[model samples]
Target: MTSPRFVIIGAGLAGAKTAESLRAKGFNGQVTIVGDEEQLPYERPPLSKDYLVGNAARDSLYVHDAEWYSDQRVELRTGIRATRIDRTSRRVELSDGAGLGYDKLLLATGASPRLLPDTAGVHYLRRIEDSDRLKRLFTTAASLIVVGGGWIGLEAAAAARQAGLAATVVEALELPLLPALGRDVATVFADLHRQHGVDLRLGIQVEHVGNDGQGTRVRLADGSVLEADAVVAGIGAVPNTGLAEACGLRVDNGVVVDANLRTSDPDIFAAGDVASVYHPLLGRHLRVEHWASALKQPAAAAASMLDKDEAYDELPYFYTDQYDLGMEFLGTIDGHDRVVFRGDLPGREFIAFWLKNNRVRAGMNVNIWDVTGPIKALIRAGRPVHPDRLADPGIPLDQVATA
Candidate 1:
């Protein structure tokens, strides 16, 4: 009898962790990871944070040591792209004219950065090379103009400021992170960047981006002109769902999967940024593009592939470090009626809870540490609490749930 073969597409954090989980769970089956990049699987958070600012080393981005794959018997195929998924024969065709048969397959294809209409000279901070290029550009460039005011744009702007480059952020919305954190908490971030000498152009759109004789030229919708030594578009990302869509898998905002991370096909699964997983707790399909999903979703995906019947119920979580503010946001702010604040909001040390029907739906800890457990507990408990007690610093987070 032959051992079952497991093939994972996209050798990223999710893929690496899935392979690791399979080995840790006593699965001696054949495991193969396929990636388009020549380099080994690596994490991406530092690309815009410590890495862009030269605080972190290049080696720190890798998910594992080079020898780990060879030791674990996991076939790591770099510089190979999975072009086609033949569901009938249970085989995957590669870009290099190779096919691999698999008993089970996992799609960790992740996402690609959404590019602007004209990206000729624009820098995007998605890959390691992009980060490296931007870091080098920071030293030579005197000014940078970031085309979006989202997390990526803001972080890139912060990195430029830290590197002594004049940075400007242009956003179409009224405030940065307004859709994600709402205006109440989003105001804090706007102030933080302004305080750090970032020129924020909010409620404006970029009409055209082109290079002039001197440098990059940006024209805003309001007929304003801005020029900078370099430009970066940190607008957003779209899931890599072409393979899934072509193979007849359900693809909505991303590859649709159940609570177990199982796709439409029983033998195929998806995790990480590409998987629009059905959250049992939230009762909706959520496609998160943060590092937390890539870091943690693999365990449940591996379990499902092994037919263990485990479900991935972890809430959507993400964190960001910009200037002096470090924040961890757990849960979703989809349908929250109001945001309750605890601790000192002015001092940037507080926990903000998104409440629906007075029940804690989501929470964010800004410059506050060691409160994730209690916040998660409160969100899971689904109990109503008095707004006064929930906003009081004197009351412990655990006790506030009952109050």
Candidate 2:
């Protein structure tokens, strides 16, 4: 009998990691990775930060060198797109007219940046080419306009400030990160950027944009205009669920998966931003687009594929760095009513906990490193914590979880 074959789509971190995990889990079958990008699978987090700032080199962005893939006996079909998944034949049809059969398949086709109607000098940062273009544009550009006040947009604005360019951010919401952090916490970011010389315009919408000889003109809804050398729209991202949806898989919110990250078809699985798995903590399907989820989900996916009874049940975690503030946030803040702070918010060093009925539901530590474990413990305990003790730095978080 021929050895079982495993095929993975979308050679980003999740796909690459799934291949590595399959070997670690002792699946030792024929493994093939298909990706649309010409380059090898690389990390995306640095593209907006270190890579954009010129502190990191291109080669460092790759998850693993070419030798690692060859050493692991993994076939890499880069620069090729997986056009269709033939469920009846258990094969994936490639754009090059080749069909690869797979006993088990994993789809990790990541998301693409949400775009706006095109105008000259407009940019969207998602791939290596996007960052490279911004690098060249930043060299000579004196002013930049950033659309959308989310993490991506703010990070880009921070990079522009670091580049000594005048950065102005336009956000339609009242405050940046309002959807995720709520107004109270989001205001902190608004102040942080303003203090760093970022001209943050809130509660405004961009009606239209056009490029002319002077520069790029961004027209506002209230009959105002802003000019800049270049404009970047970092509104959000939409998952690449075309292949999964086309194959007749359930795609509510995202490709719906159970606790095991298996799609509607038993032989197929998905992990990453594209797969909306049932979250134990949230009591519903939650689709996270953070780097931590992409890094961690593949292990569970590989294990489940091998019938190991593994489940992706860990709470979500993500981090960011802007100017001098570095933060690690654990868990979601949905249904959270009150926020309790430990340490000094004015000093920009503290841990904030979101409480739902006095139970710690989520926590964020800013400029306070190495307490993620304790924070997660408090959240997972699901016990009511005294607001005073939670607000007091004198009490360690682990003790608070128990007390």
Q: Which candidate tops lDDT?
A: 1
lDDT of 2 by residue, 1-403 (tens): 8999999999999999999999999888899999999999999988889899898999999999999999999999999999999999999999998999999999999899888776466899889999989988889999999999999899999999999999999999999999989877898899999999999999999889898867899999899999999999999999999999999999986789888989999999999989999987678999999999889999999998897878888898889989899999999999899999899898899999999999988899999989998998888889988898889999877667534
Give RMSD to native, each candidate. 0.9, 1.1
True-vs-predicted CA distance for residue 5, candidate 1, Å: 1.3
Alpha-carbon local distance difference test for all models: 0.94, 0.92
Residue 83's C-alpha lDDT in candidate 1?
Answer: 99
**C-alpha TM-scores of all predictions:** 0.99, 0.98
Q: In candidate 2, which residue pairs clash?
A: none
Q: How much does candidate 2 score in TM-score?
A: 0.98
Q: Distance from true position, residue 110, model 2, in Å? A: 0.7
